[model samples]
Target: MRLVVDLNRCQGYAQCAFLAPDVFAMHGEEGLLYTPEADEAQREKLAQAAAACPVQAILVDAVDPPAEAVSGER
Candidate 1:
């Protein structure tokens, strides 16, 4: 599984961190910390985390690889 948090859209609500502590966390003040790649077992937690985002900044399992990466051109 993979996830992406749009920092610009994030409001530091800590919803994701609270819901998915293993994958998302707060890094002092408003700074957010998280792991992009996650274990498949975390899918339910990740989904809950994404849905809990007040700002909807978390995108779970929707990470699209770069065109080159998908095409195996690089």
Candidate 2:
């Protein structure tokens, strides 16, 4: 899945960085930086980061389960 942040709405709060360091970080001048594509393991953390944004700048694409993983053998 992909993570998108609306810089226009961001206020450099860095909450995303704290919540999902693997996906989000602060640039030299406090500008937010992040990986657009994240592994499935990081999805929940990314969601938390998005919700934690004070200005609600973070956005996440809805993730679809992989075919084999959704077979539900377990």
Candidate 3:
């Protein structure tokens, strides 16, 4: 999964950080940082963070399940 944050649209609201500190954070008072490539385990938190964004600047890209999982090999 991939996460995209539009800095131009973000207002440092810190909501994303609050919702998913593992994937998102605020740098000081004027900066925001996030994991561009997030693990599948973070999907739920990422979705919550995206929804919590007042400016809707966070974007989460859907990732396909692992081949083994998809094929039910495990």
Candidate 4:
């Protein structure tokens, strides 16, 4: 599965980091570290992490924009 974290909107809540340590982590202060791609086995955890994000910044499985959405093409 794929994942995307909107770092710009993230608030360093650390909820995701606590929920899915394998996929998400806390950096020095407010930065976050995460894996873009995760194992299918981690789907449930990913969901929990995404939901736990206070700012709703995590987008799992939609990391890659759709073909027509890329570069605003039709």
Best by TM-score: 1
Summarize candidate 4's per-residue lDDT along 1-74 as a digit string, tens digits.
88889889999999999899999989999889999989988989999999888899999865544566557544
Runs of candidate 1 with Cα error greater than 4 angstroms are: 63-74
Listed in order, each prediction's TM-score against the native is 0.82, 0.80, 0.80, 0.80
Per-residue C-alpha lDDT of model 3 across residues 5-66, encoded as one tens digit per residue:
99999999998888889988889996998989888788888899999899999877665534
Mark the regions of model 4 whose C-alpha exceeds 4 Å error after superposition.
62-74
Candidate 3 TM-score, C-alpha based: 0.80
The TM-score, computed over Cα atoms with residue i paired to residue i, of candidate 1 is: 0.82
Residue 62 local lDDT, model 3: 62
For residue 32, what is the lDDT in candidate 4?
Answer: 96
Which window of 10 residues has the lowest lDDT sum in candidate 2? 63-72
The TM-score, computed over Cα atoms with residue i paired to residue i, of candidate 4 is 0.80
Query: What is the lDDT of every predicted structure here?
Result: 0.87, 0.86, 0.86, 0.88
| Top model number, lDDT | 4
Q: Of 3 and 4, which scores higher on lDDT?
A: 4
Predicted structure 4: clash tally: 0
Ranking by lDDT: 4, 1, 2, 3
For 1-74, candidate 2 gives per-residue lDDT tens digits of: 77788999888989999999999989977788899999989988988998888999877876563566656586
Clashing pairs in 2: none
